[model samples]
Target: MKYYLLALWMWSGIHLANAQQAAVKVLTRAQENRILVRWGVDQPLEWQRANNSGFILKRITIKRNDQLLASPEKKQLVRLPIKPEPVESWMNLVQQDHYAAIIAQAIYGESFEVEDTGEQSEVSRIVNMVDEMHQRHSFGLFAADMSFQGSIKAGWGYIDTEVVKGEEYIYQVAVANDASIASGAGIAGLNDFEPLPEVVDFMALPDDRKVMFSWGIIPYKGIYSSYMIERATDGRNFTAISKTPIVDINDKTGNASTAMYFADTLSNNDQKYQYRIYGISAFGERGAISKPISTQGVASVSTPPRIHDYEFKTDGSVLLFWEYPKDAEAEIQSFEVAVAAKDQGDYKIVGKQLTVSKREFSYSKLEASNYFKVYAVGENNQKIASQSVLVQPIDSVPPAIPQGFKGQIDSLGVVQLSWKANAESDLLGYRIIRGQDKDEDFIELYDKAYPQTHFTDTLSLKLSNKKVYYRIAAEDFRHNISDFSEVLIIDKPDVIPPSAPVFSNYELANSAVQLEWINSTSDDLNLTVIKRRKKEDVNWETIASFTDLTTVFWDRKVEKNQVYEYLVMARDEANLWSNPNNSQITIAVFDWSAVEVIKDLQALVDREKRVISLFWRSVAKGETIAKIEIYKNKKGEAPTLWKVIHAGQNALNDVDLDINTEYQYYFVPTLHSNTPAKAISLTVQY
Candidate 1:
């Protein structure tokens, strides 16, 4: 008896499958809290699977590009901890405390919770993505004398369908709406299924005033080869919607279905709408409605903003901000900010929901992606469109290059360089540097770092006289840099004359004054400038220019109590000026006085240490010099110099052999131009 009862219960449940759908009641939004839900618990019990294949609770989804949502979308896949159920798989790590914003694909990082994990509510794990594979069905519709337009999938195999070429199938349609929300006569499939009936069943329609509608068709065998379909409204009074006779399924030579379907792309959005399918049989019969579907109509609310403001702030952090959109009617929850590289691909969403005021957002941690744009949404709800905002961020540009750079060779074989002006904002002066030979390091020969780019390069005995190369680059006030221009090379000479001499001190005697200078190390060096100023004057006056000096020279006759000043310049065979050297003096009224002159000069001796051949020059070589002296500042000792030479001559190398200690020398040039004295050719090593 118990077995019989169980079998009867199972059969009853199978027969009541469609009735299970009626258990859930659809209610109007106005009466949502008091929804009328019915349960058939005593009739059938839900069987629980011992495995992991049940239900779960989750968050709602939001979609973009479509105003209507189709249940749940992936963006709303919630995360919550649960003990695994199949239907609740979408909920995994998200907990009840986790709050997230709901958004569409367009807005970037927006998400919502899927569900909470508790007793009965569990997060299901995915076993496989492609666990279910459905074989492709072959079918298409053909018009059996305008009866039915058939099938669903691809067109193929038709060898076994025992239908005739002229057999007909009936199609039908109906429309309905919510009784409380719309409050009108709900519609349903009008005409009953008949064997090619001649007229539509108008009385079966619920009413004419309604919002939603539905449609479908039924199949039936026929003998004629022709049929015509008629369409109607409110599932009533007949009227044909199509002008031509659609194909039939029974007469199809290839794969085909005798059923037909119709989709509505166009409808009045202001008012709710519903669509129904219709089919005509060769004998004028119609099928019952399949299902009723409603359109998701929408209304346009606002126009996009006319202008957008993109502000860039250079604080410790670089911030990108924008203004609110204009002409927005509805409150917006977020905006999508896009960024693109300066010279690269399209702008993509970098951030979103920066704010909720329909606009105004900021971004930081910026690097190379400089170009940017913004867009606005009307509570996008992930459906409608996003308005746009446009603005440029870059302000002042970089400084331009210097106007002109020209170089010319002088009679002394030195490069004379000059450049024009840079009129842009706060461009400090420029510096001139030179690279001699091809592989030598560039050196600066200017007195100051920010000197104008104009310079005169006198060949130095210390540097090779090959091609001298140079170029110029600019640095703006903001330290923005311009690259270097092409290089310019100029040729130099091989040799130069001796430079102007210098005297450390001078004094006046009863009728004579003496002068001396620290010597040099160059082999072919000569020439000097003598400067003098008589009394209180700010201007420095040159007394005379003396050339072809041997070493130090002395002047015998002079007036009493005369004060004077003198400076010198050195030169080589090429007549290039080295650097300036100077001297200062005060003479007594009438008295013979010895002048301390030479202080520091150079002396290089050969290995043999014989025949001291000294090389040095003086500022006032011809002036009266009671004596000349050379000195060196050693570590932890008083300065030492060559002995006082009252003979008025620079120190020559000596072979006196003092290898016990290291020694460096300073020489004074006791120079004379007219004296054919073989010029003391001595190589001093002491």
Candidate 2:
């Protein structure tokens, strides 16, 4: 009796808990031959308000007789199908309904009507009598629950239930947790319906008088059947042009196939026509029309367009205007503009193609020399361009200022100015301007402009001690002169003294000295002065003065063994003197005695031939002795009858001497008026 009472108490407690209702929402809509059921899983079920795990939406199809069906089979059951996000955690909740578990049962072939609840807001949890159909005999009975033990956050969920069109569906939502199940949250239902799909991507192209039209067919729920092509001349109120529907051979099947196309031979030239397409459903319902595509229905012409006038505006742009050829045989479609650098050069299209109605165009960033023309295009193409208009763009921008200007004075007092040249192609020449004082006005030095990079100004003697300032300017053919170059100020043209002359060759004799030097290389050298001083003297004396061209000097007033020092200097026309650092000194000496005698001597004789041969050597390395003497002596007789020989002949033969009688000979090498040198003797017989 104790166990029985305990069981009775537990049953009472479960009964008391049945009054708690679940807070859920359910909605069902028709799609093709199926029903899509959606629900909210935001609130907890009343049975376990704080401990719910997951939710279940049940769909029921009722029969027309208002009879409630019992225990439907599993094959007759449906599930809520929904696609999930890319995250793996949401896959079970948002996956396709085809893979969804059969969480609800429904009767096949049931027909019913669904009514809207007058209550707009969702139904709140309510207390109700417990339905005994749901039972939890053991903990294992929780196997069919969602197994999602976590709390239900606010989110939406959906499922697709298969059903017949024109049939009604009744859907009910329920939820379960680890402990128990709850039902009767809300109700909603609807019948299945369908409409035609829309047509898209319609296009039209003209080729050889035949207009080809094409479109891509879009289907609603993969049920598009065919398409119809239409045309409108006035761009509105289109009518079908094809006799039969352009069928989609793939028909209602969701697979890629060739797009539908229709070609119509143009009937009238010179007309503008628009075309569109419509998609039809399998039920023969027509859908919305596609966007229109227009084209010109005209034959091709080969004539070129004509240009009227063109000019360069002050804003650095070229404005061009042209007209369609009046004599064109075909309808004008567009006008093309082309430009070239020269009259006979290759041309390139300027900008975008223009409609025949447009007669004016502007081009920017043009070159100084440009030729432009227009080509009138028929429906087909152009054969030749119109006559070109030559344009010489005027230049108003000045050249960059010249830099690196410099000025200097030469020995001649001529001011030379130079500067870097400006690189403008239109540059004519350069001008040299000068100012005598810093605050004075600069005046052009030459009447004509200088074509070279440098100029010279010959200064007058009267302009001595005047500080001259110079600047340069570049001019163009149109006199678009650049600003003045950097000022080159040449202070008073003080004559730069000539470079000092150097002594090249000199000679000194008894009381006489001769000097020679190269002339000064200075262009304005006036003259040269020679100064001299004796070694015993304390001061220098001006010995001579010569003109600028003189290069030699002679002095005769000099004492023997006297050391003399001399310096040469150069003077320019301005009375400025060159440096005298280059000086030379020499001593006067004279030789009064004869030169030394030749040293080596020898002689040879031939008696049978009555001739003597003599040979001698000289120690004088480069100096030549005056002569050599040969003396002959018969045996036992003093040597006499001396004969003279030139110094170069070192050997002589004494012939015709006493033959068979011995004779002696001797030789002496001599210098100018010198005593006889040491002798060598030889005795010989014929």
Q: Write the per-residue lDDT of candidate 2 for residues 1-686, one digit (tens) a residue.
A: 00000001011101222234434434333446545444432222332231223444455555323334464222213243222222234335323221111111000002111112322112101111222122221110111112111111111234444554333456665554423333443232233354444566777767546787766644332444456778888998788875445554343223445566678777765678888877754323467777788885556565666778887777889889876655563466677788887789998888556866787889985765678888776554534578998766787777677777887886576877778877876666887788777678889977765778888787763544446788888776556678887677786555556778878878864347888877778767778888888877878889988884778888887665567877788887768888877645554444423334444444455544667565556666445667666677887889875888776665555555655787777655565534324456677655
Error of 2 at 486 (Å): 4.4
Tell me the TM-score of model 1. Answer: 0.23
| lDDT of each residue in 1-686, candidate 1, tens digit only | 00000000011111122333212111110011211110111111121110012112122223223333455342111232112222132123122101101101101122211222231122111111111110000000111112111100000000112222222211111011211111111111112112333212211122112222222223333322222333333445444333333333323333444443322332444443333334433321343332332333333324333334455676533444445534353544455667655435576777766554544556664542345565554432332233333333343454566557778776476678877766754454565566765477777655443536677777654464545787665554445445555677776554444433557655543465566665443555555555555555567665555565544445554445555445555656556666653334543434334333344345565656443345554334445544455444333345566455655464465554444344444443332332111111122234
> After superposition, which runs of candidate 1 have C-alpha atoms over 4 Å from their true positions?
1-267, 275-290, 306-310, 314-327, 331-334, 342-345, 354-358, 367-369, 379-686
Name the 10 consecutive residues with the lowest summed lDDT in model 2. Answer: 1-10
TM-score, every prediction: 0.23, 0.25
Candidate 1 lDDT score relative to the true structure: 0.37
Backbone Cα, N, C clashes tallied per candidate: 84, 27
Model 1: weakest 10-residue lDDT segment is 1-10
> What lDDT is reached at residue 400 by model 2?
70
